[model samples]
Target chain A: MSARLRRLWGMIRKESLQILRDPSSISIAFIMPVILLLLFGYGVSLDAKNIPLGIVIEQPDTATQSLAGAFDRSEFFHPQRFGAIQEAQQALAERRIDGILWLRNDFSSRLLSGNEAPIGVFVNGVDSNQANITKGYIQGTWLAWLQHFAVAQGRALDLPVAMEQRIWFNPALSSRLFLVPGLIAIIMTMIGSLLTAMVVAREWERGTMEALMVTPLHMGEMLAGKLIPYFALGMGGMLLSVAMALYLFDVPLLSPFWLLMLCSALFMLVSLAIGLLISIVTRNQFLAGQVALVVSFLPSFLLSGFLFDIHSMPEWVQTITYLVPARYFVAILQTLFLAGPVWPVVLVNAGAMLLMLAILTVLVVKKSYKRLD
Target chain B: MSFFHILSLARKEFLALMRDKRSRIIIIVPPIIQLFIFGFAATYDLNDVPVAVYSEDRGGASRELLARIEGSPHFSILHQISSDAEIAPLIDDRKVLLVIRLGQRFSADLQRGDPAPLQLIIDGRNSNTAMTALNYLRDVVLDFNREWQHGHGQTGPPVKLEMRAWYNENLQSRWFIVPGIVGSLMLVVTLLVTALSVAREREQGTFDQLLVTPLRPVEILIGKAIPGIVIGLLEATLIIVLMVWFFEVPLRGSIPALYLGILLFLIATVGVGLMISSIAVTQQQAILGAFLFIVPAVILSGFTTPIANMPEMVQWLTYLNPLRYFLVIVRGVTLEGDGFALLFHQFWPMAIIAAVTLILAGWLFRHRMY
Candidate 1:
């Protein structure tokens, strides 16, 4: 036991030196997180604002002008005026406009006479999420215009089925709240798996694995030694991630700091284990790096519940997500960051992370070579 | 500039790529897996949204409302909530995405022609889902109200909103997303192959051997640039084929124009890859540098999110990404059948990007030639 500890100590020291010497590794470990967080936070948004809503009105009068004005006034839409339906259809095809609001010549007369008038709202529904939001915003504009019209006429009205909607966790409907927690999970996956995967595969590629194999070192000691520095690096990256989430993006960290850290640490260990196992199996830096990305980073980004909700995915894909430990990590992170100390979710996801860690650790041990064949 | 010298170098690159069995599998396998994963996973059409309905009034009207919520494919009502205490835990657990609370006066108010207050409590951690669910619920309630008014011989409001979605009538997210996925896959595959090529040679000390050879710098540059462009074109073609034949996204645009866009886009990406390669000293550094470039390019490229939705400064920054323009071109061509004449605005930006990057890569190569 003493001998194993001493060997692990020496390996850790050597591995730390290698990590320190490689300037690129250090940059990847630290700088990449900041870049990813900023890109996701500032650049990627679900809120569809400034949607190009083309408006076509023939012979515009006061009522038609106000109707167009309603669309123009709304911050959600950038209402561009068009002269003809042909021009509007061309804009729709070019994706220059998300949807079009065509008011016929009879609209003004219909509004004055209190007759049923329907304005044509032709949307570019290729991007459905944006299209759905566009529909909602247009509806809101219509309601706003009607309320103003009713007020002008001095008509008191009572409506059936008043909808009082309340958003609980993120009241302002900021996309950051959803993306930040998911970004942390994604960053942690890269830091833990990709970095560690490269480190181990690099040792093999540089032919230092042969030397380590000749020494009186246990395989477990060497594997853990190679992974320990990266684990610390990943934790540093995690702190940087949470700090960015809290300070840079102003995402509320609702749960206890310890609980959040605990979840991050667990997920980090699983990712590192995956990297170590891939490095051992591939035995080449280039192959290992590619494999790590395919299995680790890509899956974490796509398969994890970070970007796409797992509940909405197809059944086989959902089953595939069960194998991706980042999904569980994202669940934990989202709960901790958005909803404070949701214990059952934390416990379940943590247990899943530990199970994956156990499986990956066993694979790492099995794949590590005692004698080079 | 020498034809034979460039040919030999290009052949060497082709050999280097083909020699690796792992890379061979990688080039072919990702397209299929990605196609499958994207087809199934990348959907915004909300399905089976678990909702909890709590009714203080368990009358016929209340039951009908709950039945309405259950009926939509958008929602999957878990169970009726008996008390107020059960609502919080269900939402907190996320077992129930939303809680519909019906007041005691709901049925009585409905019968007496008074407005019924319906409270929708949504867990807004995933705000997109919450908003979508709310919209679905609103539509269901509207339908129920329309039916009730028809039965009672009452009329709806004056104006009717006749909304129609063009190109994609049902607003299926697949039509919007699949084209971008093809572009994303092409970018990742082509970027990595080129980024690693020169960086690996540098790491292995073979770059010095090439530098000592009689081949001109332009020849070496051509040798490095061609494989990535060819591979990128092939990838773009493969993805387009899958999109048209398999995924069934309509090919409305001119094929020649789409291919022209692909060619220009590849030039830009390959140039970016070579630029990273010239700076990186090792394979690991090359991979990281390439990833650093790729991640932000894809994010800011208007692939997943719209560039117009971003802040003013960020929108200005997206002009630098070639994929952004390509995404527009591909989506425009596929959906709108846009010819080169119609797509002139999208065409010039990508060409400018390609020329600039190629010139930059050449300059960077010359400075770092030692």
Candidate 2:
């Protein structure tokens, strides 16, 4: 047992040395996730703000000017005056302006007299998501303006219903609250899969795995040695991510820190086991890297419900998502960060992870134990 | 160089790729599976966003508001919290994405001829989806308000919004994504396949044997690029068909024009891949180097996300990416029904990228070999 411990320790040291030597592996493990997190946090926003809108009034009347003023004051619309509606329409077609708001003559008197006044809003619906969102904003702003106007004039604006919104978990609706947890899952997966994939295949390529195989190193010990260095690295990545989430992004760590770490460590183990399976099966660094991306990164990103809600997916797809370990990890991380640890969900996820780890470890060991001859 | 010898060498390379079962599966299955999954997954259109409502008013107005919310396809009412305090736990648990709070003054505000303030609390973690949800909610509320005003003989704004969604009226994300996937899949496959091709040869000492052959540098470059281009085109065709048939994404543009654009884009990508392969000493380095380039390329290419949303500096950098131009061309032709005249903006950038990257790759190939 003592001799076996020594061999495992030696293997771990060698693996750590190889990983430390490769700058790209470290960068992929650490830097890439940070960059992605920052990008997703800042750059990629679905909420369309400061949408450039062109407004053309045929004749400048009190009503047209006030309507245009209302549009100008809107947070959603950045209203610009165009000489002609044609010019604005052209801009919309060219994807320069999202929409054009046109007010015709005698717009103000119609509002005072309580008559049907027609306002034309032309929207460029090329990108339907943006177009639909912009359309809704434009329509809502106009309706609000009219309702306020009616109330000011001592009119009975019988509002049929009013919606009371209570934002629950994240009262502030801060993007950081949800994204930070998802980011942790993504970063850990990248580190665990990319590092493990490269390390084992690299050993095979460098002719070191063969030497280790011929030695007295047991398969279990060999696997442990291979995973330990990455476990440390994965933990380091989790710490960095947690710091960023807490400090930079202002995402609250609602759950117990130990629980978060425990779940993260288990997630890392599953990811590493997956990478190990890929390495042992392929025995080539390039093939292993591709397989790691296919099995780990894509599944984590797509099936894990990181961005898209799992409930929204088709039933068959939801069933298939169970195959991905990241699905469990994403749920666990989100729960840990936002909802605090609910043991039932956490336990179930942890058990799923343990089962996956067992399966992957068995496959990797079996593949590794096969004779090269 | 004799044709017979060239064919023999090509056959040898093909056999090697075939023998590597892992590489074959990695090369083939990922693109298909990723396309199918990403086709369903990468969407901004929020479907059935879980919303919880807390109504203090319980008046006719609050019920009407709830009806409007329920009417919209975007939101699915998951639960109704009895009080405002219940909202926090629900949100924290992620049981609900949106909370609609009706204040106590809801019925009185409307009776007193004042603007009844309604509050919507959205979990803004996924800002894009939140934003969309907010917009959708606001639209429903506003429409209800407008109808109420119209019934009371109040003159509202004269302008009606006529929105015509070009490319995808149903707003199927697959319509926009399929073309992008064609470009991305081709980029990954072509780049990785060739990125390792020369490097694997170098690692096996077969590259020295190739150098000893009387084949010119241009000949070797052509040989490497041809297979990659063929494979990339094949994959593109397969993905395009799958996208159109399975996902129901429409192909509005000229097929010939689309093919032409893909041809140019593949040349640029394959050139970059060949260059990486030539410089790399081992297959490991080649794959890593390809990965380093590919990740940035995919991110900057506006595949899953929009380029316009990127920072000014990153948006500027996107001009240099061949995939960016290809994406524009593909999206333009497929969705926008754009002719060559409308697509002229895309053509030159793609041509320029192809010319520059291919030239650079060829130069690097000769430089490294010599």
Candidate 3:
């Protein structure tokens, strides 16, 4: 074997053994992804269902009872009856219900007279997302009930326009289908940075870095050796995550497996290069961990369009998201998982990740060279 | 345990933390930066959802519908395609969230008083955003229907549903998310500081040195716990100030109630952190352990998503998360203007969590001392 190859092999073996010996690296690589995927898959959902809704009917009649029963029949609401509007309002305040539907005595009379009858919807809007969803659901329920009431009179309810909504990619509108795939990017980002930075920072803290520096190994070979093991470990985590997403979570993999794997490896390289750069700059392990968490982990979690929609952000924040590498990876993963290998989306995102990898690799090389000097 | 012993230990911790300029910066700086980033970035509100119009009918009906969609702030029309084939690229590339297709018979059907079929193709990849956009489109369509019905000399619809969102009338998601950043960020900072304390000392061989000191384990725990609580309170105070002043999230409730919740939350988090620290043999393990707790705590806390949406099994699991209770207290006090009575249920759970975890951490500290 060539001298350079031998030194590189030795470094890889050392890192591999350290990773095996350290329970933290193994857990971060394997167990962390499991925990994260399970939590994100089963625990977090954007679909608001079974909302506790308070219904107050001032008068007892078949019409009001039928309207209240509509709310009860819907999967989105769990309706509770209150005798008076004040009781329902109090229920809303006590957190016993998310919203209140008040029907005055005039409600049935107005409907019977064919006058404009308004139903009051009061939502606990402390959680605006839930509030908006609740408002939409209530309107839908009320409208459907109104249409049913109109049809019960043996005449057509004239609506000028009929909306035919064809929801592509995810017809069921399950948030898990998108969230589980996006989580792979986050897990890869965390494992890449945290694993490489902590391990390298430990070497520096233990003075093994100086010993390695005196060897005949080139800086590129040393960096490559440190990264190759972690690169493999991160890819392993990604594969495990993808499997869980498919089998355990039932999120479909629409695109070819190789494309997902190839793009994931590219993004993982970018993430590892970032970790290499961070560890080289902050030689202390604690400092390295902090910087990694702040720079890599938090940005990928918050700014990468993981949980939140990116286009909806303010123009400045949207501009900042372009700097986050996981943003591109998330786009690619979501496309691959949901929309198949629409080559335009996949290629553009993969190219962006490639550019990030190149830029981060250059920065890592420059910083390591500066350290050697 | 002597008061002076615990005081000296805490003083040593403060000096050790403040002595390193980087450590000082790490503690103080990242949370603030995160505050700004999360404040701006972590929102569920959809604004300017990109849409496309594919009108096969070159008539006034399509124009009227297009005009209505154009006037709305929620959607921005990025493409006006002339062909059916053009819709695929827009939706496939996610260049447009919705494609408004006006059928060739649209105006004719409307003129004949027949229902005009308006086909809307939506990218349902991000279901929440898609659902919200669909709701907005439904409103526009409903308005168009009402106007068209009135124009044709039909009576108004049977029932009008009037919605009034109580706490946040405008339904601004930032009002909901910013207050949440306070609890989650405080948890991150305090948990890391406390979780790393014992493990870091053990890694550097100072933990054994400390064990040989005159201070009891309880005194050591107090010394360790105080700095985390103090730092957490300071960090939380800074965030609450910025959340109210900088982010413009209204502080509608009593200050004392908010602080009372913050105190209990910090103690619970610090207790959890110290437990992890006592168990971890190294700083790396402490970090992994802290993260294992942090991710689930944040996700189950209903920070961005509602806990009521979660499955029943996960809902049961969320009761164990102290952040769950803290979120209710913080958002309730901040947005809902909730006082002590309304927030009573939120307080006692965190108090219990604090008591249980602190007791467990103390026992762990003593058991691990030898």
Candidate 4:
């Protein structure tokens, strides 16, 4: 074997041993992903189901009862009866209920008299997303009830425009399908950056970096050695996350398995490069961890269009999202998992990630080589 | 437990934190950068959802419908496709989130007072965004339906639902998210500060030196807890100030109520951190432990997603998280103008959490001191 290859192999083996010996590294690579997947899959949902809603009816009649029953039947709402609007308002104020459906005494009378009886929907707007969803659900329930009421009264409920919504990709509209893939990117980001940053920074802090600097190992070979084990560890973590998403969460992997692996490996390289860069610069574990978190993890979590939409952000913030590596990874993962291999989307995103990997590789090599000099 | 001992230890802790200028910057700066990122970048309100239109009907009604869609702030028309084949590429590439298709008979059917089905094909990859955009589109269609009915001399639909959002009239998502960021960022900073303290000492062989001193375990715990609390308060205050002044989220409730919530929340988080520090022999374990708590706590805290939306077991699990209560307290005080009376329900849970975790941490600290 070539001396360079032997040196690289030695360093890789050393890293592997250290990783195996360290319980923290093992937990981070294996255990944390499981916990994160389970927590995010079970605990986080954008679908606001079983929202507690207050129903205020002043007049006890068949129309109001049927309307209340309509609310009761919806999977979206759990309706509670309030005698007065004031009581419902109090419940809303205390957050016991998310919204109120108030029916005045004149509701039935006004409908019978051919007047528009506007039903009041008061939503607690602290969570605007939930509030908007509640409003939409209320409107839908009320509209369906109106159509039923018209049918019961032997009148045709004809509307000029009716909507036929065909939801593609995710038919159930499950947020899990969307989030779980993006989460894989986040998990990879953490594994790739946090572990590498900490380990390399530890070497510097312990003065082993200076010891290594005197060795026959080239800076390139040294970086390669550091990158290889962590890269494999991150990919292992990624596979675990993807497996959980598939079997445990029942999120389908529409793209080819090899394709997913290839892209994930590419993104993992990008992440490791980031970790190596941060570690080389900081050379302090605490500072490196903080920098890695701020530069990689948080951006991956928040700015990568993971939980929030990119287009929804302000223009400048949207531009900033382009700089977050996980944005490309997230787009790639979401597309591959949900929409199969749509080449343009996948290729473009992969290309962006490739560009990033190239740039980060150059930076890491330059910084490490300079430090050695 | 000598108060002087605890006080001096805490001062030393503060000195260690500020001693490293970079560490000092790490404590103060990232939260602000995150504040900006979380403030401006993290939003649910869809500003311009890219849409594509395929209108087979060349009539005025379809034109009016297209115009209405174009006019709404929620949607931006990116493509006007001529053929059915174009729609596939547009959606497949995610170039457009939703495709508005007007059937060839749409205008004729509507003119004959028949219900014209306007087909909307939505990219459901991000179901939340799709659902939100669908809701907005439905509103536009509902408006068009109403206007069409009125123009044809038909009465409006009976039982019109009128929605009025309380507290936030505009329903700005920033108002909700920013205050929650305050709680979460504080938790992170406080937890990291305390989580690293004992672990750092143990790793550096200072725990033995400190143990030989006259300071009792309780005094050390108090000393450790104080710096975390102080740093947490200062960080929270900075974030809160930015949240209110810079972000323009109105601080409607009593300031004391918010501080009380922050204090209890910091204590609870610090307790969790210190517990991790006591068990962890290295800084890495402490960080991993801190992350183990932070991730689950943040996810279940109803910060981005509502607790009501979570499964029953997860919802129950959230009750143990101090962040859950702190979020309610922070968002309630800032947005809902909630006072101590309304916020009391949120306070006691965190107090209980603080008590339990601190006790556990103290015991663990003493056990590990040997």
Candidate 5:
């Protein structure tokens, strides 16, 4: 046992020296994920307001002018006037405008006469989410205008339905709330996979693995030694991200800090195991790195519901997502950040991740033990 | 200048690649898997969002509103909360997305000629889903108002809304996304492959032999770039065809124009990858360095979200990325049916990036030792 400990400590020392020597590895380990986290957290958002809108009015009337004026005053829309619907539609297609509002002839007369006249709203529904939001703003603004007109005339209002909207968890609909937690998952995945994948593969490429294989160090000890530094690096990244989330972005860390760290540590192990397995199976640095990226980074970004909701995905795709441990980590991180942890769900996900770690660890050890000749 | 010498070197490289089955699978499976995943996964459309409704007023008007919420395919009522406090727990726990509050005076207000107020609380942390829920709620309310007014035989000035969506009329997010995915995949695969190529050869001691040969620095550069460009073009073709055939995404604009954009974009990407390959001593450094470049490329290129949504400084910084211009051109051509005239805005930027990166990579390749 003492001999094994000495050998493992030596391996750890050697690995740390190599890592410290490589300035690029150090930069990638510490700096790259932080840059990615900040960019993704602040740069990408689905909730868009102040969309530029172009309007074309064929006739100038009080009602038409008032409607255009209302749109101009709206916070959600920035209205620009165009000479022709063709020009406005061209702008819409070019992505210069969110939508175009065309006021037909006799619009004022029809409205004043209490007739059902349809207003032309040409929406580029290609992005259905934006289309839906743009439609709501237009409707809400028109309804408010009609309500104000009715109140001024002193007529009994019919169909008096009112809507009160309350947003929960995050009342302000800040993108940081949703993005920061997911950013933690993404950053951790990148750090764990990229760091471990290159480290193990580097030993093989440098012909150092053959020397280590001749020593008293077992595959398990070598793997453990490799993982220790990265585990520290992964935790460092998590804390850095958490600081940004709390102080800078203002995303609440409602769950206990220990629990958050525990989940993150477990997820880091799973990601490291995946990278180690890739490095062992491929036995070449270039192939191992590429394989690690495919299995780890892409799945974490796409299948884990980091950017898109997994529930909306097709069933076959969801089944494949179950193979990705990052999927579970993303869910766990969101629950812990937004709502305090629920034991049952957290335990189930954590258990699944533990099983994945066991499987990957076995595979990595077995692959590493094979004869190089 | 013997053909046999060139053939022998090509044969050796092909043999080496063939010996590793893992590389073959990693190279092939990911493009297909990611193409399928991105085809289905990267959509802005919200469908079958789970919502919870709480109605305090159990009158006919409230029932009609409930029916309207249920009728829309976009929302599926998951639970019904009875009290206001339940809303906080539900949204906090993610058990429900939306809570509708109908006041007790709903029926009385309808009969007494007063505007009845309804309150809707949405979990806006997931802003895309929240916005969809809000729209669905508005549509239901407007439908109810129209029916009520028609039933009473009272004609009043009807409220009309004008909506126009820009960039895409069909809201085919795939059209906007597939091109960006093409750019992203190229960034990941091409950069890593080329970045690792020379470094791995150096680690294996084959680089010294090649350097001793009469092949000029430019010849070695061409040899490295040709394989990357061929692989990049093959992957791009597979994704573009899958997007058109399987996803049913339209190819509205000129094909030559799209290819021209992709060609210019790949030039810059390959140049950067080759530059990293030349400077890196170990394969690990090459891989790590390439990754640092790829992550920022995808994020700043407007793949999952809008570039305009970013801060003005970051938005200005994205002008440096070649992929950003490619995204705009591909999405613009596919969705908007835009011609070269409208797309002229993108061409010069991509050309400039390609020229600068290529020059930098050429200089680095000559100066840096294996």
Candidate 6:
């Protein structure tokens, strides 16, 4: 082996052993991703299905019964019959049902007489997202009932204006297509920064830093030793999550796999550098871990445009999001996964990640460059 | 058996946390910063959606549609294009989310009492915003259609639905988030501190000292467990104060019930931490173990997302997660003002988790002592 290659090999051997010895490192690197992916894929969803709904028909005539019956038949809602409006109100407060549809006695008469009949829809809007979706579902079922009623009456339903909505990219509007891409960015951040944040601090805590100081190891060599193992581990994690995204969740990978792997490797390097810098600065495992979470995982989840939109935020907050590296990665992942890496988006986000890689490299080298006597 | 023995041991754990400068800051600074950051950061409001309009008809129907869209507060009409060609690039640049395209025969058809078609081309990258913006446009079109019908001396639509959101009429997201933040942040803080407790003593060579002390094994477990609960309680109290005072989210349910739920939650968390600490040889392992629990716990808890939407098996599995129950209790009290009677189903599950986990932790403590 070449002299530098020999040194690198030795470092890798040592890190591999350390990782094997510490089962938690392996757990964080491997087990954590499986758990997170399963949680995200199977557990968290914005899709509204079988939402419990309560319905009260003041007078149970054919029109009212049919209208209420339509709600019970929908794939979107599981509706229960309520005897009175007050009973439905109590159920809503207890969170037993998500919404209520109240049909008036004159529902059929008014429609036949060509007079306006108002139906009441009460939604439990405490969870604003669920409430909003429930509202849409209720309106949709009502619209379906109207069309069905018109067809049964053998009268042409006259609506002067029609809006044709064409949703580009994801026509079905599946939340998973967008959400899974963001999940990859989040999982990468967690393993990259969080796992490595304690490495150098752990060396300090174990009294190994003093022993290492006496060796003739260059700063670059030492950083490579720490980073290479975690980089490879993080990449392994990325691959696992990406596979799950493709096969398990069945989200289409429109972008080339090689290009995504390249971006993910770059993003992982930035995250690993952040972890090293934090560990070097804090030198206390407990403190370093918390700081890493503050700087890395939380920001990746919040400021990175994962769950919330960057455009919806205020101007100052938008400025802050630029500082979070995951923002660029999330943009890349979403574009690549959904829109197939339209070059302009690819160049901009990939270039920003490259900038971060340079900055974090300098930061890591500066901290590790300090002399230890 | 001695009360004073437990007190001294508890004091030592408390002082150990306070005396460490880093621990002191970890306990104090991050929670406050997270509160401010997460409060502002976690928003679901689809505010300030930028849209582009392509109106071909220079007639009254198109003009009226434009006026109605311009009036709504949710949209900022950033661009007006006379041609269809200007749209794709603007959407590609993400400069506009929705493009309102009116057909050439739009006003003519409306005048002739024939159907007019309006095309809304949406950028569905962020599906939630697209859906909300679509709903807003629908309301405008419905209103326009109704007015036109009335003006023509035609009868109004036979049936219409009136929507009202109960409890939270406006559905302000902060009402839910503030309470959720209280549960999630407290879990992390308490779990981290307790998970590191046993591992720290072993790392510092104080575990041997602790083991040789006059206190019994059960008392030692109590000493180790109490600090996490106390710290968790302190953090929970600070967050509740913020929810009530800073955010002005009303405290509707009995305040006692909320604390009772928190105490049970802390017991379950501390039990988890201690169990991990008992087996971990290093502090890093302990923290990672805590993380293993925290990540899945928070996700499964329905803190931000609803659990009912989850797969049937996953929903059943959430019964084991103490945070799931606590969140229900917390949201109940804060949003619905539900009392203990209505909240029993939430509490029993949590109490069971606490009892089972604490017992298991105590067993592990005994096994380790030997």
Show model 5 residue runs off by greater than 4 Å: A116-118, A152-159, A341-345, B1-19, B80-89, B103-114, B162-172
**How far out, in Å, is residue A310 in model 4?**
0.4
Of the two candidates 2 and 6, the one with more favorable lDDT, higher being better, is: 6
- Stretches of candidate 3 above 4 Å error? A369-373
Clash count, predicted structure 4: 0
Task: Provide the fnat value for model 3, as a fraction from 0 to 1.
Answer: 0.84
Candidate ranking under lDDT, highest first, comes to 4, 3, 6, 1, 5, 2
What TM-score does each model's chain B reach against the true chain B?
A: 0.96, 0.92, 0.96, 0.97, 0.91, 0.94
Candidate that beats the other on TM-score, 4 or 5, i.e. the better one:
4
Off by over 4 Å in 2: A34-42, A73-78, A104-113, A147-159, A164-177, A202-208, A245-258, A334-352, B1-15, B19-22, B53-68, B80-85, B101-121, B146-162, B366-370
Query: Residue B135 in model 1: shift from native, Å?
Result: 1.8
- Interface RMSD list for the candidates: 1.5, 3.6, 1.3, 1.2, 2.8, 1.6
Kindly list the per-residue Cα lDDT of model 5 for residues B128-177, writing each as its tens digit: 66766677677778778767766766564475554445555556566666
Weakest ten-residue segment in model 4 chain B by summed lDDT: B361-370
Which residue pairs clash in candidate 4? Answer: none
A1-373 per-residue lDDT for model 4 (tens digits): 9898999999999989998898788888888899888988887788878889999999989888999999999999999999899999999998899899899999999988889887888999989998888888888888798799889999878778888999999998999889989888987887788878887788887788898888898989888998888888888888899899999988888989999999999998888888889898888877786687677666788899888999889888888998888999999999999999999998999999999999998898778772553
Go through the candidates in order and give each one's C-alpha lDDT: 0.83, 0.74, 0.88, 0.88, 0.76, 0.83
Model 3, span B1-370: residue lDDT tens: 8999999999998887778898899999989988998899988888788998988898898789888888899988888898989988989998999999998999988888887999999999988888889888888999998898888888767878888989888988899999898988999889988998988898888988998989888899899999999999999999999999999998888889999999999999999999999998888788778878887898889998888888888999999999999999888888888899899999999999999998898888768753
DockQ of structure 3: 0.78
Please write out the lDDT profile of model 6 over residues B1-370, one tens digit for every residue: 7888888999999998889888798887888877777777777776768888898788987888888888887777889898878887777667788998998899999888877999889988777667777877787788888898888776555679899997677877777777888898888889888898888887787887887878887788888888999989988998889878887777888778888899999998888888888877678878787877888888888887788989999999898898998888888888788788988888887788878777777677657652
* Steric clashes per prediction: 2, 23, 0, 0, 21, 0
The second chain of candidate 3 has a TM-score of: 0.96
Computed on C-alphas against the true complex, the DockQ of each candidate is 0.69, 0.40, 0.78, 0.82, 0.56, 0.69
User: Which should have the higher DockQ, number 2 or number 5?
Assistant: 5
Q: Mind giving the per-residue lDDT tens digits that candidate 2 earns over A1-373?
A: 5898899889899878877886766776677667766655554444466888999888887667776888889877888898887888777656677678877665556645655666777765446666767777787787677667666668654554554554445655554567667767865786688777867777778787778778888888888998898888878877877888788877777788988888888888888888888787777887887776666655676678776667667677778889888888888887777667767668888999989888887787777772564
Better of 3 and 6 by DockQ: 3
CAPRI-wise, candidate 4 is high
